[model samples]
Target: MREISLDRLRTLVAIADLGSFAEAARALNLAPPTVSLHIADLEARVGGALLSRSRGRITPTAVGETLVERARRLLVDAQQALDDVQRQVQGLAGRVRVGASTGVIAQLLPQALERLGQRHPGIDVQVAVLTSQETLLQLAAGTLDIGLIALPQLPVKGLDIHPWRRDPVMAFLPARWEPPAVVTPAWLADQPLILNDSSTRLSRLTAEWFASDGQQPTPRIQLNYNDAIKSLVAAGYGATLLPHEASTPLPDARISMHALAPPLWRQLGIVHRAGDSARATAHVLDVLWEQGVE
Candidate 1:
């Protein structure tokens, strides 16, 4: 026996309500023969007559009555399911798992999320703090839906990546020191540099920037957190290089920001699985694009 067709079930309901094959056909936008065919198919499948025709009146058999009632409930459920998925596609609801660096999570994501919450409240964003390389790894492992990572990275296979923004690398020095308006890599190399530690892409980029000038500036101290590095810099521990957004110079004006000569920019970008179709993920990416790197 075959599964009962929804069309046939609907035709059964229409026929029973209209009390005539011709009338049901007209209501269903089908021919009288088509309506009769639907009833015949249904009766054969259920091994019973579904309608009794008497003097132009069509009364439904017990089987027809029971199935038509169930069909109405099923149709309602099916429509509800459709509506739910449609909302999901519109980016109104879903969950997005994100992985990003500390700098982005601290300075950028909070601002983006503020607007995101106002605009897409149904979309829940979950974040995990990770470095650029770790984010890429998680994206590949399918543990992350999207990633905010440093650009010019070694390409990860099967990932869709694009540059989002480039923030100028700035040097934060102690308040007492009056550095030049435009600091050069050579000049920065000579200072008691506080590097961002080798665990981060920033560390490699800064090191390469110094190396490009045929200079190897050794860091007086290495710290991972930007706040900690700034605290140390404020106390005259050493100067630090960071993306402009990462520098928090307020509350204690002990650090000053200076532009870099031949200004180096820390390129940041968003990455996701190729052909990602998650609506929440796309919505977040769109928000990031519209929001830019604030």
Candidate 2:
């Protein structure tokens, strides 16, 4: 079958709406012959007469009405597609896929996303909670546009990871427990601990901090989500180690925050493809950079 031309389809729809070839030609800025040829070409492609002229009035034949209705929908979709592309080209709109841990997403991403929405309301940021290793894999595979990953990662190919934030790891103990002014590994090791899951970088970092002083105490329970761990600590489950942002409000008053003796830091980095990013992605990256600490 012969492929139909959008231009001819447009001409047919215009003629049917105006009920005259001359009016359609005038409306479309085409000559009378060009309008006639468009209808003729369309008829040949479909093997049917598309228009009827009787008693000085023109109207679409049955086939023409069907084609015109469908063409109207097609034209609408085409115009929308063009508009979307144009918005992207103008750097005024796009969708950005972002990956980060549950903690960062809960605590930090909201501030950055709020700034992004104010600055570029047309840009949409879709965030996924992922582990650092999973985030790195997705970034390398070109699935994620931006990544907020834990630092101290082995370099992955085609990815550009830069340190973004460093927060001091603190001990979160139940308020009911008599906590030390500064929590040391020896002090924390003896307490029943509610800790991060073994998969997380924060878990490894805290483990290393404990191991440095030869204290390899086991945790009572391990979890991935920061808020859940904090809730457990508040419930007097056990003491836990977590990074704290100065500006973030503590979820519960029942949990006491204490600094680690040999202060351990939780580091985070942003990752993207090693080249210039799309404008929307750059906008999000700028907001994320603003969230970073020295």
Candidate 3:
């Protein structure tokens, strides 16, 4: 079957609304002959007269009125489809996929997402909670739009990475512990230590710190969640090394933070596809840029 032309449908609607071919031609910036040809061709295709001549105006015949009604709805739908595509291309509305580690999601993303909603209610943020390494993997795979990761992560090409923040890695000890002036590896080695699990970058960093002093830490327990370690440390189970920002509000009031002798830190950075500057992503970056990243 031959599909109807959108141009012809539009012409039909204009002619019917204006009540004359000459008037529609003027409104559409087309010659009257072109307008009359449009109507004549439409009538021939339908195998019936489509308009009736009044004293000085025109009216649609029964079939023509039916065609005009359908034409109006069809034209509206076509225009709507165009607008939706444009919005997606412009990032004016759509879902932005974001990947972040547990620490960032817990402490930072809540406020960021809240501000994002207030400013651009049309853009939705989809969050995935992954470790820093995992977050970087997803970002490189193109499954993530933005990634918030703990550094120093191994660098990868095709990614735009920039430092977001850095916080001191401190010794978390029981609130009433001697409150040492500076926590040295010697003191940490002697204590039953609760450290992050070996799989994480923070764990590796802490291990390197201990290794620097010719000491190998024998952790009483290794766990991934900072809060859990903070809780154990607060109960006097052991001292722990954790980023100050990651274990905020101090999971337990009984836990106190002290700096390392030489001061260790966990750095955070943001990652995204190198060439991706999506509107929603850009807007989110704008809000974050003002956050004093680095």
Say which candidate scores most in lDDT: 2
Ranking by lDDT: 2, 1, 3
- What's model 2's lDDT at 122? 98
lDDT per residue, candidate 2, 1-294, as tens digits? 767888999999999989899999999999999999999999888889999997776899999899999999999999999999888767789999999999999999999999999989999999999999999888888899999999888888888989998998899999989977778999999999999999999999999999999999999999999999998899998989999987588758898888888999999999998885588888989999999996
Q: What is the RMSD, in Å, between candidate 1 and the native fold over all Cα?
A: 5.7
Alpha-carbon lDDT, every model: 0.84, 0.91, 0.82
In model 1, where do residues sit more than 4 Å from their true spots? 1-90, 246-252
After superposition, candidate 2 runs with Cα above 4 Å error: 19-26, 29-34, 55-58
- Compose the digit string of candidate 3's lDDT tens values, residues 96-163: 88887666677677777778788888888899878887888898899988888877666799998888
Q: Rank the candidates by TM-score, best first.
A: 2, 3, 1
Q: In lDDT terms, how accurate is model 3?
A: 0.82
Clash totals for all candidate models? 0, 0, 0
State which candidate has the highest TM-score.
Answer: 2
Poorest 10 consecutive residues of model 3 by lDDT?
285-294
Give the lDDT of residue 133 in candidate 1. Answer: 85
lDDT of 1 at 76: 79
